[model samples]
Target: MKYALKRIFMLVLTMVIVSFLTFLAFELISGDPAEAMLGTEATPERLAALREELGLNRPFLVRYASWLAGFVSGDLGVSLRYRQPVWDLIAPKLEITLCLCLASFVLITAVSIPLAIWSYRWTGTVFEAVRTAFNQLCMAVPPFFTGILMTYLFGIVLRLFVPGDFPDLHTRFGEAMVHLFFAAVCLGIPRTAMTVRMMRSTVISEMQKAYVRTAISRGNDRHAVLTRHVLKNSLTSAITFLGQTMAELIGGSVVVEQVFGIPGLGRLLVYSISTRDYPVVQTVVVILAFWVVLAGTLADLINQQVDPRLRLGGAA
Candidate 1:
């Protein structure tokens, strides 16, 4: 209970710091938001009035405080570009990004674990060599590049789906999911490769430990010892690694969305940044930071539950 409370407190504090930094960074950026909105022909008087209306005329600390308060109270302000409430602009796009992330995560988990087990079970065979080479290839290629390849292969060559023709997520939910699945495959491949390597390494390490030898000496079959003991112990590290990968998937999704021309938060964020939409950009950045931090915290908590040493304040 104490640990969880401490973690929650830290989460809140971390979000506060992230939000402040996001706000400050945009404030320090070169362009004037007022000018960006109004364009070059606008008079100085118009710019001043626009700044006042957007509350950009206030002291930095005061504006930051107000923005933070609005964030906490579920009033995320209005987007200068869209002329809509920031949350309203974000909500649908958030769903699309969430769907993409979720699909990528599911793909990662589904593919990594089975392949890891297979490679571990067949340690020194031809299959293992091929699997190792495949892992290297996947890990070597970045997701964005993989996304481009997928677009060429599936979208163009095979005529599976047209590139940059994403369906309306609200109206064609099922078809939209099919399109996201392809993008998810691109986003997930490298992460799946990484997880496989980590899981395999962890399993190998666990197999070398003293308990494994003891169990084997006491007449437990090697396979029994592996399945009953080594695999379970190895999964603790895998769980933590997967959590970190989940956080990474958000960044990866941004690139994937661009390649696929999906109207997700990543696309919105890029547009917002280009247009100097401070409210939208700041909100999206802070949300991404929150997810990254929350993923780490959740991973740590799960590790504490899975490995007693973590709960006892010992090294993992």
Candidate 2:
């Protein structure tokens, strides 16, 4: 309970810092939201009035405080570009990005674990060598590159889906899922490869520990010992990596969304940044940072539960 509370506190602090830094960085950058919004019609009077209306003319700390307070109260401010409430702009996109990340995570976990175990079981065999090579290849290739290949292979060549023609996520939910699934595959390949390598290595390392030899000496079946003991111990590290992977998937999905022309938060973020829509950009960035921090916090808590040693160490 205490550890969880401490982590929760840290999570809040981290978010505060992230939000402040994001706000500060945007303030430092060269771009006038008012000018961007008014574009060719941005006269001196119009720019001044718009800045005043948007509270952009306020002191940095005051604007930051107002934005932060509004965010805490569920008011995400209005987008300068869209001229709509920021929440309204991002909510649907958030769902799409979440679905994409979730799909990629599911793919990574579903494929990596079995492949890792199989490769471990078949150590030194031809299958293991082939699997190793495949993992290496997957890891070497970036997600965006994989996304392009998948787009060409599945979208263009196979006619599985149209390239850069994403279905309306709201109206064509099923078809949208199918499109996201393919994009997820692109994001998952490299992460899955990484997880397999890590899991296999950890399992191998655990197998060489003293307890494994002791269990086998006591007439425990090697396979049974592996399933009951080694796998559990090996998963601690894998869980940690998966948490980090989850955060990476969020960031990586941006590129994948762009490659596939999906209207997810990542895509929105890119557009928002380009348009100097600070409300949308700030909100999106802070939300992404929150997810990243939350993922790590959850992983840390889970690790402590999985390994008592970590709990004790944390307490100390």
lDDT, candidates in the order shown: 0.89, 0.90
Specify the poorest-scoring 10-residue window by lDDT in model 1.
Answer: 307-316
lDDT of 2 by residue, 16-52 (tens): 9999999999898848888877887668998999888
Clash pairs (backbone) in predicted model 2: none
* Tens-digit per-residue lDDT, 8-82, candidate 1: 888999999999888889889847888988999999999999989988878989989999999999899999898
Give the poorly placed runs of model 1, Cα more than 4 Å off. 156-160, 313-316
Clashing pairs in 1: none
Model 1 residue 231 lDDT score: 83
